[model samples]
Target: MAHRFQYTVISILSAVLQKCGLRCTRKFGKMLGLLLMLQTKRRMITYDNISKAYPGHSDEWKGALVRGAYVNLGITFAEMLYSKALSADDLINQVTFSGLDVVAERARNGLPSILLSGHFGNWEYLAMAAGVCLHKPLTIVVHPQHNAYLDAELNTIRTRFGNIVVPMHKAARTLVRTIQEGGIVAFLADQHASADHDPQIEFFGRPTPTYSAPAALALKFNVPMFLGTAVRHDTGKYSVNVQPVPSADLSDNPESVIELTHRHVAMLESEIRANPHLWSWQHRRWRM
Candidate 1:
């Protein structure tokens, strides 16, 4: 009965979102974000996170950044809902690749790779763009939504353009096998991991718990790893920038797990610093 209600709400939302189209829906999302920014709970979380990350910034700066963060997420949400209307080419054309040659060369040699990114930009679109470029489906590690109806709907959209979604809880062995079979695996490594399993890593000069699975897998399977970002442009298009993870970082020595993980976190931090507004700052990133 609860699932039915959830499905009904999503059905109505889908109908309304489709009618709004991409551009208009994004505009509406931006406006909605502005309204959401006024809500105390999320507003405070965003402000606190920004203050911690940018210590010297004024309240005005923090507020503007918080609003921008909300707007970015709103745009992303709108684009995602409207994406079902887009064909593969439409999705592929939305992003320009800066380091395709590197990825292509690696792919040509049948080398499996682990691609890492954060919560910046439209991460789902990033996966879609890579799927188009790689000429094969890429398996992505994702946290399953608690709402069964919503999860199924989201999974359909995510996989519509030839990508596989692997639930995070049971992905360790599957990810290893996927890479071993010369397949691509992607991870959003910025999210906070469980306290018990997470490795401490530095982000913006503060210690935070981060998922170490990607680093551990890269070392264990000796697979190449790359860190990349999908940067949104003023034209509403996006460009993907990918950089290879240095081999030295993923040293076979067990001690290197934390080191490799730090490098990934650092890469994301650098990107976030460059475009502070592009990230989701409302999420509690640090316990400190």
Candidate 2:
């Protein structure tokens, strides 16, 4: 009964938000962000993250960035809920791509790739747009939501546009077979990993835990890899930049995984630095 109630409430909210259209929804979402900024504990965590990631900045600058981060997140949430109404061609038209030739070439030659990105910007669109652009289904590794009803509802939005969603624990075999069959797979490399999970990497000059599956998988399969992000512009349209993952060497050497992972981390860090507001800072991403 509770699950049904939750699903009903979320469905109603999504419908109401989409009726306002993208621009109005984002405006209202930004107002919602202001409310989030008032939460003391989360505000402090966000402040500390910004302070450490960027030192020597005044409190005012950090405050604006933190506030903007929340607003960005609100907009992201609104856009994601509104995405259910978008058609495949509508999704494709919303994004302008850079380095699409890489995806195009890989798709044409029947070569699989690991498409990686952080939590910055509209990361969901990155996966969806890639499927449309490459004309192949993409398997995205996703952490399961604890609530089964919400999980099913959210996963429907994710897979609605010709993409496959794999729960993280069950992703290994599915990812391998999908790539072997000449398909693309995507992963979020910026999420936190426990020290034991083999996610040692440097982010924003701080030693932090990060998911290394992207590098490990790419190296293991000898597949091509690309890092991409969908950045929202002032007009609310997104421009996606997909580039080859720059790395030293991708041999099976143990150090190669660390190096490749750092390369992906560095790329994401650069993007976040360029637009700190577009990235989420509310989480406890860094340890004091």
Candidate 3:
């Protein structure tokens, strides 16, 4: 009974937000961002995380990044409402792609590739763009939120562009099947992982827990791996960059996969360094 009531509330809220998003203007969007910055605890945590990550920065600088992050998030949410309503030409005009040939080359060889990225710069749109550009559905692995109603709504929106979202719990089998069928599987590997599920690795100069499943899968399937990231430009547009993972000759030993994974993470660290504000600073990514 409680679940049903919650679902009803979520459905109503989703409809209301979608309507508002469709009608939102630049001025009103900025105002909404201000309101969210003032009221959201998550935003506050994001500020705190930024401070910890860059202790040399002044309070003013940290404050600005926090506000900017919320504004960026708000814009991303609003744009998602218009995702289905917009055409590929419209979206393409807003986002530019780089290193696309890497994806193309791998796909041409009939080899399944693992595309790894993080939660930065409208990551959702990156998957959608890949689905359109690669001409192959990109399977994204995600964990459902506790609220079933909201989760269902988000899943529907995410998969609208022909990409598939697989639940993280069943990701192994789904990934294996996708690879065997010569499909691309994309996922973020920077989140904090449960002790039993993820092994500890050095991240951002600190010992952090990260998911090794991607590495394990790549090794088991003998598939090539790629790195992709999107960055928010000053004009509020986004650019996605993809690159082939550094070569590793692991024919004789399987443990080389772990080293290759760490190397990829190191590359991601350089990206995060280039634009620290684009990252999800609030995540307790380094926590044990």
Candidate 4:
């Protein structure tokens, strides 16, 4: 009964989003974000996080950033909903890709690579577009959504353009199989992991719990890792940037895991730093 209700809601939302199209939906999302910041107290979390990261900035500077972040969050939410209704025509015009041949080259040379990225820009679109952009099937490791029905729907959209999704629990086995078979694997590596056991890495001038799976996998497989990001442009479009993480000197070892992990985190931080407004800052990433 609950699943039926969820499906009904999703169908109605998808229809409305499809009608509104990407551009207008994004405008709606921006407005939604503004309303959220103005009406809700969650803006406090945004302000606090910004202060910690950019302590030297004045309150006005920080507030402007926070507004941008909230607007980004709203735009992202709308985009994700519209993803379900996205057509190839809509995707092609809305997002553009660069540096894909670099990673795709690995497969041509019998090398399987790990793609690392963060929650910057339209991350969901980044993965979704990479499916078609790379000209090859991408194996994405994602955390499962609590709602089984919703999770199924997400995978449907994710795989619509020739990509695969594997849940976190099954990621180890699936990634190994894919890598051994000379396939590409992607990971969203920017989120804060459980601090209880996860190693803390320096990010944005502070030690933060970071996921090391991608680093470990890259080292163990002795394959190259590519750091990618889908950045938003003033034209209301997205541009994907993919480049290799400089780690040719590192061998498969515990030390390499830490070093590679830091390198990827730093890469993500650089992107977030370059475009501070494109990132979601209200999630309270800095526990300190």
* Backbone clash count, each prediction separately: 0, 0, 0, 0
Stretches of candidate 1 exceeding 4 Å from the true structure: 1-6
Model 4, stretches more than 4 Å misplaced?
Answer: 1-7, 38-41
**TM-score for each prediction?**
0.95, 0.95, 0.86, 0.92
Clash pairs of candidate 3? none
The collision pairs in model 2 are none
After aligning candidate 3 to the native by TM-score, how far in Å is the CA of 177 from where it should be?
1.2
Better of 1 and 3 by lDDT: 1
Taken over the whole model, the C-alpha lDDT of each candidate is 0.84, 0.83, 0.75, 0.84
Which lDDT tens digits does candidate 1 get at residues 1-288? 898798797677667888877778778778877877878987898888899899998888888899899999888877877788788888888887887677777778888888998899888899988888888778999999888888888889988878999999899888988899888899997877776668778788887988888888888888878988888888778888998877663577667888888887888899999998998897887863
Q: How many backbone clashes does candidate 3 have?
A: 0
Local error of candidate 2 at 122, Å?
Answer: 1.1
Q: Model 3: per-residue lDDT, tens digit, 24-60? A: 5334455666677776677767876777677898999
Please list the Cα RMSD from the true structure of every candidate, rounded to 1 decimal place: 1.6, 1.7, 2.9, 2.0
